[model samples]
Target: MVYPEQQLSERQRYYNAKEIAQYYRSRPWVVIWRALTIVWLFARFVLGLKLDEWFNRAELNKFKRAGQLRQILTDLGPTFIKVGQALSTRPDLVRKDFLEELIKLQDQLPPFDNALAFSIIEEELGRTVATMYRQISPDPIAAASLGQVYHAFLTTGEEVAVKVQRPNLLVSIKLDLYLMRWAAGWLSPWLPLNLGHDLTLIVDEFGTKLFEEIDYINEGRNAEKFAKNFRDDPTVKVPLIYWQYTSTRVITLEWIHGLKLTDTERIRAAGLETDAVIKTGVISGLRQLLEHGFFHADPHPGNLFALADGRMAYIDFGMMDQLAQPTKEAIASAVVHLINRDYVELAAIFVELGFLTPDTDIMPIVPAIESVLGEAIGESVGEFNFRTITDKFSELMYDYPFRVPAKFALIIRSLVTQEGLALTLNPNFKIVEVSYPYVARRLLTGESPEMRRRLIDVLFKNGKLRWDRLENMIAIARSDQQFDLLPTAQLGLQYLLSEEGKFLRRQLLLALTEDDRLHTQELQRLWDLVKDDLEPKRLFDVALSSLRVVSTEGIAAILPTANTINSL
Candidate 1:
């Protein structure tokens, strides 16, 4: 029952592939030129492939070398540009100079034909452009590597933005990616040194994300999900999708009017508070990573906006990252441990989160964690710079078995980009400090009873409540509009009476009173608090058992001084 149109479509695809293959076949000389250039550059810059010892005449500067590579990738076109951008995010895989250069690879490629864009819109929607939009701008508003966006108005008088795919983009990208894979296969075995990642691995990862980025349907869905996630939040805005006009090759969305986040002067002139805007951006970013578990992976300044009403609007949902429930919970737990500087528990959480293998030798990893943590903490307890610590940790683990999970890599990149943007707005802004309240709120108000109990464990040690720490946590939680203490406290108290909690309490008491004289008063206080909850006989039996164990070590004086169980 195939119609003539369907038959023609199939035949067109066949020709497209054949044409692409032929196009690549005609480009062997280009490939050889690029490959040889890359080989020479890599050898000279990375491997020190110098001609003569006497001609040591000042090796080419690293930044200059990166510039040369950028030129080569730029000349090779879209696929290489995408690869360079991906490499820019992996500071652990490349030198800082090269990373700096690669990050500057703008997607501002030259635009294709306006006729082609309008024709694609018409063909994909099965409607005439004249009927679809009352007025459509002939010139594109923005042009990038994959596609271009145009300003248009629907017949219903609603202003909208139309994103049109470039003509034969898939075919061109397919050919480029095919050659990339072929090159990766050819060069992988002969690579002189490990660049921290193989070409095959990088190409495959880039190809998947690249393909996903070009799917307008997926992009529309991503926008809808983001809108759903933040529907109730007044400070955040997600674009409204115009499904009546959206398809794989073309998507339409409500046009948002706002100033670029980088335009601090204009944002301020519009009566928006810069600090408040940055705070909202950071908090929303945190919520995406920690609470929602789905986040916009590419959060550069260009993609974010500050509306007239002070709300932050995020556009371009092509790149998004998701964290699983276990990973999110582990991250929340890690935040708590990190704040407390509990390196041991942090190490365990790292393994539990799959940051390291289950059998990873914790002994070797712990010191590395300690060194990074200690350096970040510096001379003060409250001073925590997340970016510095994360960078140091990445460097420390570069050569080791340590690997950042795929989702985590995006998370890191997004947060780093976010913080960088915030700093550009205000140089004195401290992202870690600004983010602490959000982190504390998530840890203290989590739904899990275990998480609440862990909060208690963190707030107390050796039967003494860390009042200062508890107060700081409360202050931070209060800053969050969503934080509620009553329910969290109730859940924590219920957990305290459970068998697991009781065992943990006993262990804490034993560990505290084992050899320290400082807990003499705290132990009595803690006993008075817990004695009513336990049967008198059973409580006395437990106390007496502990006493016998302590008496054998001749530290009986450090035990509770109450004469009778009644006094306790």
Candidate 2:
């Protein structure tokens, strides 16, 4: 099971910005000419719009201007197209009209020459096309900014997709990045941009990720890693990478047969429940972000398919990102803070996560954060969606000192694109409604020590138990079909009996006693909630299974108490 990355050289395995800069520096004329053309194009459309605004001329149709901008990016080539796709998710930077148009950049770009694409595949793979594939599409089935995918069948009669990268893609992208980084330095002082972070750093961050995307070998490895992560999940599917035929410039993957998640009519006709599809997407997405931390950053409709068997298939693993352990914990905690409507703590988390500068006064920003998030969430979590929240938060960012960290750019893009896809399938889809159950289940299960601490923070305050929170978490967690009653109960019992549970034990004891008397009312309420799920047979089975993990002495110690309970 040697990975594709292991076959590549050191230079091919990672993005080397300095090497790219040096390579392009030897060809200065290429950069200068391209930079001039880009400047002219922007001056004609972007600067022209600003000029029109300053002179207070007749108002032009914003939608029309946005279309022109999209066309300009399309003409500019792959690098600009990628930038447009990134901007499509940034409601904070781009206006509504432009954002709508930039969304087209995801998969709507025109294809390159078919003959050239075919020739490149042959050259890169070092094989004649007729020998390698039994059949290949005469034209690309789908065209994206970086590459176009051709549906083909291997000589072995297996259906596959052959992806061919654009001609001179690295040369074009390198020149563009170098020029953009150079320009960011010169323009930062004069431009009226209010982004708190340095403009050049953003360009570098985008450059790093863009470099990662062009290496088809890296993408093959990404697909494998992602597949390994979801190995146990039956509801989600990742395309198998044909590593034998994969190279730096071309990749072959299992051709998925399904309708796009956005194709509602066909999806419903296939007898797939739209809500169930959305649930799978949301839950799988939560696992990627909150659990595995390695996530598919680009989840556009074109990259996601709804299979006939009701599984959601994710393709295009080139644009993926990972989160560190601390970052994962911070995100989970942020969700809790948001649910609690604790804006002050939420603002602090934002600062800690680099969304705000340390010197920024959070006190003045707290109420504004509350107002935006509160209005979106209101009394019902069902009302919340990423688009609505981002739109409002965009305004807040404009008025306040908040900034979008470069690392989080793809994160926001992934979430917003997912919600948009969900909305396309079911107009009434509420992401928060589907998301909270997964988060609640994760908190309740307490998979890690940090998570257990978070659960405790949510369940107790001032040395007192919050029975309502515990009950509500259970209610929400049970809604997930994957939630297992016996395992969760066993984990809870094990933790309660451990040394780390000393504080919780004291708190529970205190909670069960009042005025020198024991109160069974809360205990009875909890039992009533769990009784249906914990049938006698299930309990007996769980007890029998527990014998493997529990020592005989441990069981003997608890037997007398169990006998007393049976007698009662």
The lDDT leader among the candidates is: 2
Predicted candidate 2 versus true structure: per-residue lDDT over 1-568, tens digit per residue: 6644333467744656678778778988888899889989988997767876887752665777789899999999998987787677455467878877987887778999998998988878888899999999998988899999999999999999999998888777877888888877788766443453557777777787887888888889899899999999999899999887888889999999988775789999999999999999988898999999999887877688989999989889888999987777778778767876878878988988888889888998899999889887778767777778877887786678777887787788888878877776677788888888788888888889888887887778777787877777787778777787788877777666555655666577667664455667877888888888998988877766656666656545555544644554
Candidate 1 achieves a global lDDT of: 0.69
Q: Candidate 1: worst 10 consecutive residues by lDDT?
A: 1-10
Task: Please state every model's RMSD to the true fold in angstroms.
Answer: 10.0, 4.4
> In model 1, which regions exceed 4 Å deviation?
1-75, 83-108, 175-203, 380-383, 453-472, 478-568
TM for candidate 1 is: 0.72
**Winning model by TM-score:** 2
Off by more than 4 A, model 2: 3-13, 16-32, 46-67, 86-104, 182-194, 356-365, 395-401, 514-521, 543-548, 552-568
Clashes in candidate 2: how many?
0
Compared to the true structure, candidate 2 yields what TM-score?
Answer: 0.86
